[model samples]
Target: MLEVRRRGLTTLLGGTAVGWALAAHAQVPEKIPRLCFLTFDPGTLTSNRFGAFFEGLRDLGYANGQTISIDYLSVEGNGERFPALAEECLRLKADIIAVSTTPGAQAAIAATRTIPIIMIGLGDPVRTGLVGNLARPSGNITGLSLMVPEVATKRLGLLKDAIPGISQVLVLSYLADPIAPLQVKAMQEAAQPLGLTLQVHDIRTANDLPAAFDAAAREHAEALLTTSESIFVAQGQRVTELAARYKLPAMYCFSNDVVDFGGLMAYDVNYSRVIRRAASYVDRILKGAKVSDLPIEQPIKFEFSINLKAAKALGLTIPPGVLAIADKVIE
Candidate 1:
């Protein structure tokens, strides 16, 4: 009888160990939340934009596989694919959709009213009807905006001041871009007061850029100013290359392109800050703070960057006044 009791006790202990292991496994989260990243630009995992965002998420106690998984999609500068991509993310039942541009934001908004949508560097969300207001987004969409209109005006003035004798300025922009019309308006309004004539050229594709530069040259444009739009951002290297190849004194809106691709000067909002700021909104949503409760944040960090090499290539001199104010100067 004592031997029988010992065998029964061993069997009981074995069953208890198995049950405890199963319970422990069950207690842990079986399914991680899935995030969908949709962008009009080429969406590589290594893109600095995503890296910064992931770092921000890590700070919030969630890492890949442990808490969440991100499924990314890129349009590769093709607007036609955005709608389909957005719809697919919705069909995949993403917990949240993070979009990088206005077009992508609009696509996500149209795809679902239920899913929380976080925008990155969208231009004029209020004007575009992406959100009702900054303080209260009032919808499933909320995030950071691109440069303010007044900031755009100020950058143009600085460009003219830095490039003395720049009376006629060539403005490069995309006609189909969501920010183009507003930028053109700002350029026109700002140029008129400065006595600068704005020669606008619409570059719908890469092939059209050379012709646009030729037109700017034929018109005797003394300087060039490129606007910040999603397509232009994706083609930053190409834009800087064309500006150099054409030898037009140019200023870009993004410091990344200016520093990386050698533009003479750049004044714009800090992109990493924009991405990191959006991470806060994502955190709030996950913590049961409704997106509606979160206010759409504006850019608090702005920067001015100058490239001395590019300035020398155009035979332009960076004024001491501008140099003193620059946040970064690239040699």
Candidate 2:
């Protein structure tokens, strides 16, 4: 009878050990990292603009919803919504916040001091106080700089080249975007050397766009140059239509804007490439790298795209010199 009791006790002990092992296994949490993407452009989540980011993450062995999760918040051209959207990301306990544009970066920085922020396509982070310096951010923010001034100069040069004898140019900028003033200054500086006159027209909302176009017409602007602001990019189709309606040849910042949206020409960094590089920052941060250690990067390449159909619609001829150097020409 003692032997029987001993065997029963052994069995109970073995069962308890197995249960404990299972419980311990259940308690071991999965180490899936969470990323929050904050953008002023609403179409980022749904369009190919942000798809490049996911593709980059995949290249780094991170598959969304499987190995990692992403929470997206877009203000959709409403600058006032940025702070609240950033707070929402904080409430969700995001491990890292990836911000696109200066306004989104500003909102994210204001929302959390502990969470790491990866800024993409920001203009003059140092001037805007988003970072101490490009080499060492010294805070929880670092990624890619759009190098807005250089790009603006290049775009204006292309515009001058495409439309020789074009004297007056209208700059359509969003007044709400912090980067707008800097971009306008860069354009003005670029215009002076080329003997091109630039008139600044600030649009505060989508409703203000029509009035800005009317102002452009009243100024007798020869060509239109739109800033690379989220609000302006979000209204690309409208801007293109208005430029056509006003009979003004327009130059855009992104090649896709010209190739896809029917703008006259564009000279800027390939946004897809920049966003892809930004994903590397995310990967490093997830692997326990500090934001301050990761230095800010700038685009190594810029592309020029021209729409032949758009030029035709504007009754303009593309100089052979311009067409010869274009990376992409859409007919």
Candidate 3:
């Protein structure tokens, strides 16, 4: 009798343990959501914007191999490769697609209308016709915008401030990017008021960058302002080196100019903040929130970063007032 009582107690404890295990497993879903990330700039998985965004995802309770799995594909400055990459992501049947810039977004949208598409660090989505409007993006696409037209003018103004005698401003842009034309228009409008000669140059490939800089120098551009596209950001070091080599005062639209060893002043959106905000969007979507219902967001925190070291190298003195207002001054 004693032996039977002991056996019965053991059986009851084993059954309770099994029941608890089943309940826990039921709470945690079996299949993890797979997210696909496509970028125009091909950089290492540990660095650059994509890496930062990946880290952001982990902070939001979605770590790779745990809750969410990511399939990352990069085009590495090849526009032609975007379509094929987008198609591959769709073929994987990604739960959500995260893309950078206008071209990448278009490719993802074309690949699948049903899957939610999130864009990071893109210019005016409405003007580019990526979405219907900012307040109500009535589609599967919604994310962040960098506030282009106004931001363009501010970059020029900052360049002028850096170089006081700046009579000519050279603008470097990517022709294929839809935001380029709008940025150019804003730069022209700002130039008219300041009496600054605006020389716009189009660059399609990385090899063309040196020649474009040479042209800007030959034109006697007193200052330079480059756009914040993936192409230029990918080649941040090269662009900054050239700008310093030419001794031309250059302002960029990203912190990479200062942090990644390039350019002088960057009056642009706070990128980490943008990526963190993107994580929030991703989290909401994963929790069954509609992408269309999550209204697209614009950056509220813009950063002004100045490299005093780069400024000294170029023989330019940064105005004290600008330094006073700068969010970061790299000595």
Count clashing residue pairs in model 3: 1
By summed lDDT, the worst window of 10 consecutive residues in model 2 runs over: 41-50
- Candidate 3 ranges with C-alpha deviation above 4 Å: 1-29, 257-262
Residue clash pairs of candidate 2: none
Best by lDDT: 2
Once superposed on the true structure, which residue ranges of model 1 sit more than 4 Å away at CA? Answer: 1-29
**Candidate 3: which pairs clash?**
257-262
Q: State the C-alpha lDDT per candidate.
A: 0.81, 0.85, 0.83
- Comparing 1 and 2 on lDDT, the stronger one: 2
Ranking by lDDT: 2, 3, 1
Deviation from truth (RMSD, Å), model 2: 2.4
Question: Which rank order by TM-score, best down to worst?
Answer: 2, 1, 3
Please report the candidate that would top TM-score against the real structure: 2
- The reply for model 2, stretches above 4 Å from the true place, is 1-21, 27-29, 43-48
Q: What are the TM-scores, per candidate, against the unseen true structure?
A: 0.89, 0.91, 0.88
